[model samples]
Target: MSSRSMLLALAAVLLQTPALTQAFQDDLLQQCGTTTVFSNHRQGRLRQSGVSRVVGGIPSPEGSSPWMVSLQLLHPGMGYVGHICGGVLIHQSWVVTAAHCIKNEKYALPISHLWSVQFGPELKRFAIKEIVIHEMFAGYNHDIALVQLSNPAPYVPVCLPKSGQGFQGIRCVASGWSTTSAAPTTLTRRMGIPGPRAHVHLSVVSSSVCRNRYLSAYNITLNAGHLCAAGKGLLTSGTCLGDSGGPLQCNMADGRWYLAGITAFGSGCGRPGYPDVYTRLAYYLPWIKVQIKKHESAEKSGNYL
Candidate 1:
């Protein structure tokens, strides 16, 4: 079997393990403190328009999306060259990403395996203090995780949606270091083939429409926690292999940008009928708050402060 297939099969078996299931259940149900309320910490606006004009996407301006980051894993012989996924800075010390980014198919990898988080256009790397993956995360459902920076990043965080905020028809942009090429399907073929940085403008598709499309074609059912978005122009364009766990950001009418989604998965890169799926931020807001609070409390207690 292919490595990807092997991993998926292993994940299925591990998910059924009683001890693992119980541990995850206990963590999922753990109570959290209520002191710190969740809110976005905006710094200021940039002179450049949030929109990018390049076909794929030009190298992002210095501070355009300061919250964007690259998560890397160090292999025994490869060092930090392996770029596992992308992430967003939700707070000075907190990052949000897909849980699968930090885990293999069978188990959550050790913290030592995580090398660093590269932030901003300069791509300064920072050590990680802690990682908190949602306990209930099973495969694609609840596909979210948080990373705490050993030292706080100086960049301003992107705002999160207010409770119940609607995203339908909103124009959101997806950014990553993935290839700009349009045809490659496998990761190896697209490896290191860099063009302009990827920043594709996409429109949010309604959940019902996205669900129906996936159901009809792939027999997959999408839940409310998933956001579906398609490319804006005639030419097919969206995220690919290296873009997992990156942000799907939307600029609101108030001129503030909010993190609306995290790129999760897709049928193929920029296929005409298949919209890329993201882990909807609003749906997971409560869980996010609880986890952050729990971690913050632990730090205060010197668990890794």
Candidate 2:
């Protein structure tokens, strides 16, 4: 069969299968087993080993951001698995990410099309139980989604902000396996060999400043749901390709890291003056709580579909 035809056939198969009843789902969960208990904070006894920080950014010490996760998909015809985006483990079974990460513009694929959520120091893979995309998401505006894992993994979830909390001007960190080089060849190689994740320090830019900058350049005003940040002048420090859906986390006064934003879009990776934009978590807190509650209610009633 032709390559295009083959892809069509595979996508058909993926779409036809029930997301919650794939044959490998049970086996994959069983094989993974219950290895570690989930928590919002890392235990002192747990070993810290695999963390690394991002583009034009410094290398973070290993295992620093335990909530970081790589969302991937398998391309059978291409003979490779691809890391399409990054996400955060928000709960034992729930993950938060950019809605665009899971939506295919060319084709409306099923949730089962997602290969797995690779996380932890060893980057173990886990099957997704369900996917919930924000109903109001349009392009990059409200670009957040949630994924429920078939089984919980051994990792710490990131702390979420309470309603009405704000994070303006706060220094935060964004980490992901995004490519550092702008060259095409480097991008391809980086995607294949996704090395240690990298992180960078960024200061939150107020909505007025961000809106003014974008309005002046792209004739687009920043929305209320968006948050912006950048590194020190012309330093070229920020997220790049493959970093979408990753968390922009801030350390609170209480000593716990709370997710401040979700990497959404930017003019270019680490480009001076074009600060990175994220979907502000504060604006979507109520929506998130509702989705979690709805999912929990469905699960309790054995209607998890």
Candidate 3:
């Protein structure tokens, strides 16, 4: 079969399989609260070894471009552990990701280690000067954060949608190596170890539908600043355990990619009914700007306080 035909056939198989959706969702949702999504090891006592940060490295884009980018975080002793989180390269040195993915922690590593940035789906390394979390995002209200690399990425990063722009029912793809494991059968504090296979999938969902389902649970009030997307069918295919901090990118009429959301939470990976939730990046631009300014000021003064 031709490559195009092969891709179509594969997509058909993916959209038709409820089990695949369930598997994807289960992995991503299982990752919440298990330390930052960038950290590769499972929750519990932090591991001295293993890929420690982010979900997994970015995979190659097969077509024009996959609507996803890579995220890497600092891990102690392990060097920089890469994971898949959805993000848009907004500027030369800055990219946006979910605050929950790297929030609360002032440094990417534990203040005792170094962190680096890797861009595109290829997992190349770059030096990251600092990570700036939205000041207003104390817990979850505004769950967006930014990473400023020491240099620009080689690949063209996606840009943020203009303020007030909106999208629905767009064919979007988020790529990441998701953990392949279900939540422990029982409700216990401990979680199962996610398998090593890195995974990625495609889905198309509406903003209103996602808001109606997730707003109450995540405590978000959608507005011009917030953009949303979701998957349809009996099961929604999405980013899973290793897919946190990734982007939900949608295409626009002008043919440029616009970042619509950042993976935040979901009722589960691909439950038949529940929709995945993401932190609305545009909603918290003011906070993001403030953070950038703070970092700049600190740099100018030679102090980070």
Candidate 4:
């Protein structure tokens, strides 16, 4: 072929690359939001009669929450990483978490190298390649972050919400792994097997109702990016576990669990009558997509922050 013809062919291929990539990305996510291990019977029973085991929740089942990711920090003295927060797997190599989990507090940077994510029922670990914090994040204003794992985890990812999916009054479950039953007390940590995890039941509260609750109780106004959720049980108790960045998942009518939000923050490790806050995933899905697309190649290329 002539040089001009060859150049035209190359340009055509280049123009199609992004569209092809997008198609593949969509296909991959299409296979997500499900796991062969999730039992419909077990979840039904739990929903019917789940007792307050950890504060106002019960321990998670082994096959449950296949997309839950435990964020761990390396302990300099202990020489091992332990669960510090929680995250939800959105894609094979991407996780969604609360920005406050790794926010820069003069102690830990948002893009710190010490952070990693542990997932799967076997509890395998993966190194964090890149962290994308919301650019407008400031004191929980935009309290969500996207995490890029160094390699794709061979695990099923939780489904993102359909465009404009509303979550108010929806009964959801928030799952998190912790060493103790309540606020961190003297407890021995475990490894190489399933650790104690809590599956707290919560009901999504409307933004206005949540705002009023916070204002009347704490005398503070909340950001619109946050989701307010009241705890499940008598009197609608809030979560007391205090595991940040955990998933606030709701089981949709299709018998599939969709990731609604991540644990953002709560005052005093949560208490009765108040609703807990979460980084509404639906509100920030666009930001999440842009960050993930922009950084999808970062893991394979040169170093980036």
By lDDT, the best candidate is 2
10 residues in a row with least lDDT, candidate 3: 40-49
Q: lDDT score, residue 239, model 2?
A: 54
Per-residue alpha-carbon lDDT of candidate 4 for residues 1-305, written as tens digits (9 for 90 to 100): 54346334433432332222545656667766665433332221111111111233465667677788777665444433356567888997798887776775634555545567777655466777787888888876797888887666666688898757778888887776633444343232322122466576778877887788778887867865788776653245445534567778888888778888887666444565667777888888888888877775553486454
Query: 2 or 4, which is superior by lDDT?
Result: 2
Q: Candidate 4: where are CA atoms >4 Å away? A: 1-28, 36-56, 75-81, 104-106, 178-194, 232-234, 297-305
Over the stretch 1-305, how does candidate 2's per-residue lDDT look in tens digits? 54456445435533443334334544433332122222232111100112211444444566577778877665544543456678988776788988887775843433554456777546466767788888887766788999887776556677777676668777777777634435436543433334465666777776787788778987766787888877665244375432788888887676667788888877654556777888888889888889989988998999977
The local lDDT score (0 to 100) that residue 274 gets in candidate 3 is: 52
For model 4 the local lDDT of residue 93 reads 76
Task: Sort all candidates by TM-score, best to worst.
Answer: 4, 2, 1, 3
Candidate 2, backbone clash total = 8
Better TM-score candidate (3, 4):
4
Itemize residue pairs with steric clashes in candidate 4.
none
Worst ten in a row by lDDT for model 1:
44-53
Predicted candidate 3 versus true structure: per-residue lDDT over 167-216, tens digit per residue? 55665544343332343243111111222323233344566665676566
Ranking by lDDT: 2, 4, 1, 3
